[model samples]
Target: MDAHTVTRIGSHDKDLQELFCDYVPQVFRRADFRRWRAWGQWSDDYHAYALMEAGRVVANTSVMRMRLVLEGREVTGYQLGAVGCLPSHRGRGLARVAMNAALDACGDAPVLLFANPTVRQFYPRFGFQPQRQTLFTTTYDSVPEGPPALTLNLDDEEVRAGLVALSSEGLPSTERFGARGYATVASWPVANGFARPLRQLGSEAWVFAGVEGETLYLDDVFAREPFDLRAWIPRLIDRPIRAIRFGFTPERYWPGAVEAGEDTEADLFVRNLQLSPEAHRFPIMAHT
Candidate 1:
């Protein structure tokens, strides 16, 4: 422990970023952090506080500074992520050291994080209270179908550029609780199962979604201008879906959607903000 030191690194530090990325998969098996960084999606908003030994990251907690919409009002906030210590470093309080440094860097901004079950008890020690999110869902009904949505690959330079522009101007899916300026962070979902991207309304709108069984999971949507989501949803459906589950609050888009129950997001914790149950959900794709 005497040889350990904490270091703060941002996305601009290629060497340190690589070290963090290499350590990430050891904790988060499916996070393609390196690939995401290579795509140039790691923005300056993200920073990592790492406990280093001999210049190698042994424990880390990353933060993403963001503009969050809380109960329809905009506020500055931070989302903590990628928090873990190497197997050998666990139980030595190294993770706590990294987390404390990250939280201090947040500088009083409301902070939130998703924790794994294993660390559910750890966050509460840092003034974080568990917060439950609402799951919005609605029964699917048959509608007049249009041509299927065209799949746009993010790998395509033109498509990526278009998305970036739209993301900068797009309205939050829900004013209750969501994020602004989140284009780069969204690449995580694009790499995960929600790989399909669809653009409509002359490419002014885009949707990221995937299907499982009789359900269509709408991961995220971006549009330069507010549009009729209910009316345009029928056009986006290519297969049968008896129900739709939204990854973001649906009050602004689909007024008829009902609160199903607690969202799948477990072990969620927040500090310096009151997030009442069923009020709204932090947009899924916006999770750091």
Candidate 2:
């Protein structure tokens, strides 16, 4: 391993980093690579660790810093992702070294990430533990007049940015648990699933979501004040939305809404469980 040198990288000439993706096709496929590259919302504090061997990238890991509100108090956290290592470089301890560097930089800040079943045991070495998050769904027997709102196009950058900024007022937002999509628009639907932007008129708040079959899924929601959850199902879509589902847990409850069931996010692990139940839905567009 002494022959290798690890370096921290930022958003510069992304071309050079393509080698990392190419080396780990199974980790970051063609589409996933493109999604992260073109993702609109990127933190200036983005951090990626690269292992250089013979002047070539041999291993890598990316750390994303996010602001979260835990139990009504603001705190900083890290979302570690994009763990990759070259197949030819196996047994060289590249991944362990790279992850150590990432965690070291993170200090005592809490971290969140999802892992596949095969690699599930790998993360426990870092003190990550699986936790159950709660998400809610319910049927709307009749259409009720929702909040005053209008839909926005994905390209509505200025208005969308402003709305997102306004929406991030509260901390500890999570998908399927009131997790807002302020981290990145990609989080709106996660995996490039269907998504639509909606603005709660009077409050100037926003939400992005999509529907399939009879269920309407709220990918992300934002508001300066507590948003009327009932407004989400009725006002946003025209079809007969029989069921409304969301990752967010609102301050107030809707009349007919009830806790339908719970979903287990396999491989989703966290270190230091200060806050909880941010209904952590698997991000459709989030590659990590």
| TM-score of each model, in listed order | 0.93, 0.77
lDDT per residue as tens, model 2, 72-178: 44467777877878777878788888888888888898887766667877788988887554556777543536563576654556754665576455423342322
**Each model's C-alpha lDDT?**
0.79, 0.59
Candidate 2's displacement at residue 54, Å, is: 5.1
Candidate 2's displacement at residue 188, Å, is 8.3
- The prediction achieving the highest TM-score against the true structure is 1
Question: What is the per-residue lDDT of model 1 for residues 33-84, given as tens digits with 9 covering 90 to 100?
Answer: 8667767887888989988786678899999988888777888999999898
Q: On a 0 to 1 TM-score scale, where does candidate 1 land against the true structure? A: 0.93
Relative to the true structure, candidate 1 has a C-alpha RMSD (angstroms) of 2.0
Scored against the true structure, residue 273 in model 2 reaches a CA lDDT of 47
Which runs of model 1 end up more than 4 angstroms from their true locations? 1-3, 192-201, 276-278
> Top model by lDDT, which number?
1
C-alpha-based local distance difference test score of model 1: 0.79
